[model samples]
Target chain A: MSAFNTNNFSTNGYELPASVGASLKPEHFASILHTPPPLGFFEIHAENYLVAGGPFHHYLTQIRQNYPLSIHGVGLSLGGQNPPNLQHLTALKSLIDRYQPAVFSEHLAWSNHGNHFLNDLLPLAYNQQSLNRICAHIEQVQQFLGRQILLENPSTYVEFTQSTFTEAEFISALVERTGCGLLLDLNNLYVSCRNHNWEIQPYIRALPLAAVREIHLAGFHREIDPMGEALFIDSHDAQVDDAVWALYKSIIQQLGPIPTLIEWDNNLPPFSDLLAEVQLAQTILDAYNTLPAKAQP
Target chain B: MTFDAAWAHSLLNPDAELPADLRVWNHSDPAIRFAVYRNNVVASLIQALADSFPVINALVGDEFFNAMTAIYVRQHPPRSPVLAYYGADFADFLQDFPPAASVPYLADIGRLEYAVIQAFHAADMPSLTTQQVQGLLINTEKLAQLQLSLHPSLQTLQSSFAIGSLWFAHQGAGNIADVQPEIPEALWILRFQLAVEVLPMSAGDCQFLQALLKGQPLGAAAESVIEAEFDLIRCLNVLLQKELITHFHYL
Candidate 1:
């Protein structure tokens, strides 16, 4: 593990704000550090900050002072055939030890296979054996972090024929066995639903909603394959599509104010543009929170 | 082979047959669906290598870099998932890559970019001020045994070729055509956010840092400098001024 001053953990120097968050980006470092926007917290991809020193840690230390942090991992490869890489886990543990983010999460996909590591989040077949491995990996991650981490459902273009369980069923079972939380990336849900022709409502209902600790809202790329099928790739480059926004509305209406993260990793706009998206989420969350308890569905 | 291994293999080697039991929609072609993933896996990594070594990409142009990267990534997929520190072996790969061989110094540029990016991610430590440097030298005996701690983001590259000039030319500091190789150059890289600056150093100073980086004490490190014009006090001040030396601890 890299050396870090242990538990230098402190609050974002404010009473927690709203339940809407934005995935932190390097482009907004100066602006966010100078004047933090009103959001519950910021989520970071754990792999981005795995360096030993320099401006990343320097600015993060300062910005983290005002916003609660959520460290998300894309490299954990939780569903890989081999055990999750210990070095990746160690780097994650060090970041967690230093910052103590409010929510720590990683995708359910596996990127590393054999000796080679792929940068993309590749899908895995959902079978009992795969389930056993993923559960074990999630347990290992939580043990290292000493905190509950939410496992995110990945955006996949294809499905495996031999898999017995649905994605929702698989994630729900992992949550049950490991006591891990769920980060329902609504955009991923939308993309996978379209690609596989699965309905969003039933999948969302089948998921262990109570265990959900956060929601990810990102945009996707839509293209027609050679077979003339619409393939919704979770590209996270464009604006949140209308279909995704509708799904997000339905989800928040049901879930009610879970920490919603607006993730824009590629083709990033100015900080103000991201803020505009965050504000939209904040508005929906505010409206939901204001609804009478009995009226909320 | 396990199903996961088959799927993973199919990505890099398109000829690797997919496991027969693999699932996809019956109507959609499995090959193309799988190809989407293969494209994503390859493209994002190429993008990552591009991000890490942009100057190299600028020098080679996107068309050449992309072609070189496509082959390089297939042969040498990253061993770890920390994408920021990915492409550690690209420099070595370039040294052997036939297409990149025409620009032999391109690999050195790759190496320099890797060092710069790695240093950028290094942990932050407060560099010592001039007063702190003076305070450590209470006496020659004490100074002789002092092992100076270099700043976390400070990295030096000593190349037999003109790495600094080529790099400076790429960053708009000098004309690429004006660069002419003379002596072996030591390039210094330091980071502050998106900004990274590379400074050319005398061979003697590079030797001095190389020794200090290996945890050598001051008196012995100074003696290791091979250049005849090496000045101990002046080299120490250059390091101090550049915020390279974090602290000096006596052994």
Candidate 2:
């Protein structure tokens, strides 16, 4: 598959078709591809397309041929207490072999414990034990797939008091141990920073920039408690907020342009709206390309 | 706690004490952030359970289903991030789930749905053709030691309630009362093309497939069916059409 190029799309930018502002169903996905965005790629959750021979799998396979696809996995609890699931690993490996995604990624969070499976990307303890477990899991996964996998940072709600290391340090350790690249979800960083009351700049800067390969920007809904405490939910139900877009711009400025994807899963707008989001990212990337090196720092 | 271990430790258990960074959230800013994560964690999980077991959700209604999922979510929290494989133990949970007892058939429905999902994701393999089976079965007496291969997408579930009828009724077919109880159904669930099909099995067919699944030789499998009801030809025909019995290999 060709590497995604932002300049490939129609010069005239995209707009949401009047008919589909509320939702984009399976039927709508086919037409949406024809009105392609400048950024010639799409990222889909791997689990959503795991079926024997259904429409989900059918559409994914059809669209995958045309687009520079990336499979973002939400499951594969890489930081779990137990070893990486061989069956799950085998299944994932099969998918990678089949699709040949430009980037294959899973979260740093643990979702399963043993027999029980937590559907959410639950946080993992950042002590030596957890770090060791995550590294081991990543190594096992990389070995099984015979390829490097990108690990995305999750949007966490709460932090444990027992944690002995910073999130960036933990991720850096994993990269060092497993040689896996990073899929920096800027929106997650912003949400996590606000939730943890940490400075976002230091956290972003602390990342092992050389290992960073891809970027994700998703929309979030705001939630508050009775105490008036704020949480930016990574709901992916709306358009990329201005704050998130700003973060994306900063990451691009620092890291140079990367393969960026706009994730709008639930509460989806029309095909044109998705293309517009891609156009916005492309515009930012184009601006970075023209900037002088000395002028940027 | 150091910054590195902060988020990792928080994810292990929901009630784990918050780290300094996480706990230091300002009332105005952090609450929304925390609520966002918390709500997504709960809602997405609940939604996954609802998706996998649509019948359970439909039977219980939205309010009760949401409530049941909340309690289930807290008690048997997901250990994996994959929601498709999340609710494996939900059937067992329903047995002790107090509110769900009113809908006694809920657990069986969950089991059937789980089986269907398992069949759908099972490894890909080709079924034995009629000609291939015939070539092997030419030596009928030798069939006693022949091990039969089954389709990867084949699943069999035996339920006392009219689960097949009940499951069918909920498929936007018609009213629940219109479903006749008939006899208990040992469903032969198979995924052909894109659809997961649940076909009601006769007593003999169920026994024969159950025997074959146990790795019994063809002779034993057939004997088990003949003992239940001597309809060997009819059972073989059904198995052939469903493409369940893949091959009869000599052991």
Candidate 3:
């Protein structure tokens, strides 16, 4: 019943990122903003700026004037059984109203359980019950915010046994039912595929291309088993791997270029490293734009 | 419960029996993904707590912090998404923790740390001027009944142990044992301009502020402090200079 029509938006090739720089501290954020690369938009974890009239808010306002913004939320626990927190929704709505970010997104998994807040993205069962629940939660959020939200697929160490629907199927169903867009994190696809011993190509191919409005590329850590089976960690602390970049190329080649963000959260390097990754992403995005007519979307 | 709500219940408690109409019950791999979520939810909360209460974590060590956080997470999950304010109840959790009981001061330390964090994020506002204070004293006799408003982010705490010393030490100052803990300490945490700062207050100063905070006018609050060896003039100057007292109301 909301007026957030996703498929009919002006596609006229919205500005695609060549690459984007990322930072956690406000001083570093200000410094990065002043010397922004071609893809100038900066993304921030929404939880960091939830405060009112503080230094963080002050710096964000200063930065907002110069660059396009994206609010990537780590909370909201959309897949949990509990209804979305009305207070949290109100807070997010307040942020959206203030920033008017180019994109607003949260993960498919739940972070809070019952009355407890876990502060991490938990996995959800991909079943009809979950599908309906997530759809309803998404509907409530969209209706309340009065705008469409892009839901990102979560990185996982395990898959739910009760999931009747495949990851792609669950995503497509969500787009169909709630009209929410997808934020495909190519690194997450690679991470999930490598962990679950699945083929990444089919998983990427199965995504609802038209619904994907944003792309996320981040680094992952690897944990090896006694048998040398590698478990990829979705730790956003390092550089984007070559395999993930390859997947990004593959995704852009088919789905067309999307607004991309390069996330680096832990063991954060100096601004140059993040800017370099953003540049790397932009280079790939540009390559897709100039791909031979046969390869272009 | 509806299928969606039932699924939610199961996600929070893995031991909960699956609802009959739950969509995941018909899935080929429901438990696998369920386990992934279970791991994520628990791990994420544990990390948030660790991040917020670094001193508590450092005092207990990483292994201990992780285990204690797991128990704390299960017992006290955050009710709001504003994680900066999420661990407000953690101090209480430590007081009741059986393992933490050995370190009786742990709870009070958590309280002090929580207060500092609260003060750090409190709103920004200008304070009352000295001229305004002088004007306010025109009705000096009614000062006892006058209530003084404190900053939104200001937090005043009193503890029996050397919790204040322990906290300051953990903040790269010095060791807590180095500061003798024979006497109880009253502490004030406030944002003076841009940074949040913590300092110990004398018993008289503490009593004075607490009384004023409780709606007592300056006359009555100063009397309480005078009995406790506080220099009324000096305290008033400090309060005014620090911009702690925002407004005064005479009852």
Residues B1-251, model 1: lDDT tens digits: 76667776788887787656645664667777788888998899899999999989998999999999988888888887778878888999999988777787888889998988877777667777667867875576688798988877777787888988888788788898888754467876775434566877777777787888999999899988887756677677767666777777888
Q: Model 2 chain B, poorest ten-residue lDDT window?
A: B3-12
lDDT of each: 0.81, 0.71, 0.74
RMSD vs true structure, all candidates: 4.7, 7.4, 4.5
User: lDDT score, residue B59, model 2?
Assistant: 78
Instruction: Tell me the docking grade of candidate 1.
Output: medium
Summing lDDT over every window of 10 consecutive residues in candidate 3 chain A, give the lowest-scoring window.
Answer: A7-16
For candidate 2 chain A, the 10 contiguous residues with the lowest summed lDDT are: A14-23
Every candidate's TM-score, chain A alone: 0.92, 0.87, 0.91
Tens digit per residue, CA lDDT, model 3, A83-197:
8889888989898888888778889987665565666675666889889989999988887877778899878755655778888888988888888888898888888877767
Model 2 score (lDDT): 0.71
Best by lDDT: 1
Residue B201 shift from truth in candidate 2, angstroms:
2.8
Rank ordering of all candidates by lDDT, starting from the highest: 1, 3, 2
In order, the interface RMSDs are 1.9, 5.2, 5.8
Better structure of 1 and 3 per DockQ: 1
